[model samples]
Target: VRPKFIDYYCPYTLGGHFINACNKDGEPVCGIYVKVSVERLNDISEQDAIAEGIDTDWLAESQDNYDCIADHNMSGRPTAKGHFSYLWQSIYGDDKSKCWEKNPWVWVIEFKRVQEQRND
Candidate 1:
């Protein structure tokens, strides 16, 4: 099966949810994002991918939680392993209370989905 790609954004901020809180440059801020392939989403329903989207809570987990399928993999770059890599964004603050005043972090992930073929 061919994989369908999607990009998702997380609405959660330390103070509150996106737009409601977290001010950036005098404007309500939205941060934290991810890129993933949901080839399996179509199997359940045509609109499943669009409706369910990415799981923000799962993506929020520590980077160590995910196994790296590839490294330094990106568009136009030669991939040593998988065809595509996952991408996500995050930020770290000096104090948990001041998450708005934080440093930005980005991640690219690589993974593969394997299925067993059945013969009758």
Candidate 2:
């Protein structure tokens, strides 16, 4: 998923992270902001490792927060064998994590980009 801005401590170099307003420390740090949608929905099967597009169930569950649905489709976590990706989080510039202060249904997901995995 293309985030509005990237975090300085981003785990992945290819992709970026999301930082909340309060999460900023010291001074306001700039990030790599992107304005594109690369998120997709795919249906994969265990039979043949085939992937196809199907209706996303998460859409219905996204009524709580519209941004959640977009984040899910965009930065869904990557499995042991998957494609490029990133995670979304809300940092309100404080010791307490703002992202974690959401309902159980809502979540600030962790990004995992397989493309950046180390060969060693």
Candidate 3:
């Protein structure tokens, strides 16, 4: 089971623990926990939305060009949160407990990526 982010905080959580990963070249990546927090899904910030890889440009351009379903009153310039909300719905659908509109608590983990040479 996927333990909640809180599990990573308590002695039981692996948030602050050492985790290893490798890139395509098999170089070791030292993943060190830097921070962890929780936030409501709908309360995401523009910065966080962008960091999560929302494409505001495409939303705006498509809305301005061929998106007949877009809200007529909207100017088609999608904010980061707006774009993210659209993507969120696509993933979660309208599930009452999990959809973005329900504003569920989510885990936020920040880590430092340090790549090291392969030992072997």
Candidate 4:
């Protein structure tokens, strides 16, 4: 799960039992596991979609389907939910086990961004 991917994506260093980390560039970064759950991709709600960061202007972490943000929404979504759908589809469209049309059960991780701390 996150343990497999966090290293590749975040690249941090641990601070002993103190539980701290920094990036490859030595810029301090820290995160603690908040929570993780499983849900159908299609069951995502507006609040969850917003929490996924669609409203903040970042559509998807790997989003290249920007047109869907506004244009696809005209098809009856028109909100954070719409953006999230596009993101999900983009990320998991190839495999039936992860496909949006299949409404696959996906691990949902909730992270709360806090104020930056030292590079400890």
**Tens-digit lDDT track for model 2 on 1-120?**
222566455665434644443223433333333333332222222221212222234333445444544544545532311211112233232225533233223222233323332348
Q: State the number of backbone clashes in model 4.
A: 1
Query: Which segments of candidate 4 are over 4 A away from where they belong?
Result: 1-29, 56-77, 94-98, 117-120
- Per-prediction TM-score: 0.18, 0.15, 0.57, 0.51
Model 1 misplaced regions, further than 4 Å: 1-95, 98-103
Off by over 4 Å in 3: 1-28, 63-73, 95-98, 115-120
- Per-prediction backbone clash count: 1, 6, 2, 1
What lDDT would candidate 2 get against the real structure? 0.32
Reference-based lDDT, residue 93, model 1: 27
lDDT of 3 by residue, 1-120 (tens): 121234246564366554335555655554678999998898889988988887666656663433323632345365777667767776778545557667889998888876565569
- Which candidate leads in lDDT? 3
How far out, in Å, is residue 35 in model 4? 1.5
Rank ordering of all candidates by TM-score, starting from the highest: 3, 4, 1, 2
lDDT of each: 0.32, 0.32, 0.65, 0.63
Compared with the true structure, model 2 gives a TM-score of 0.15
Candidate 1 lDDT, tens digit per residue, 85-109?
A: 2222122323344432232232332
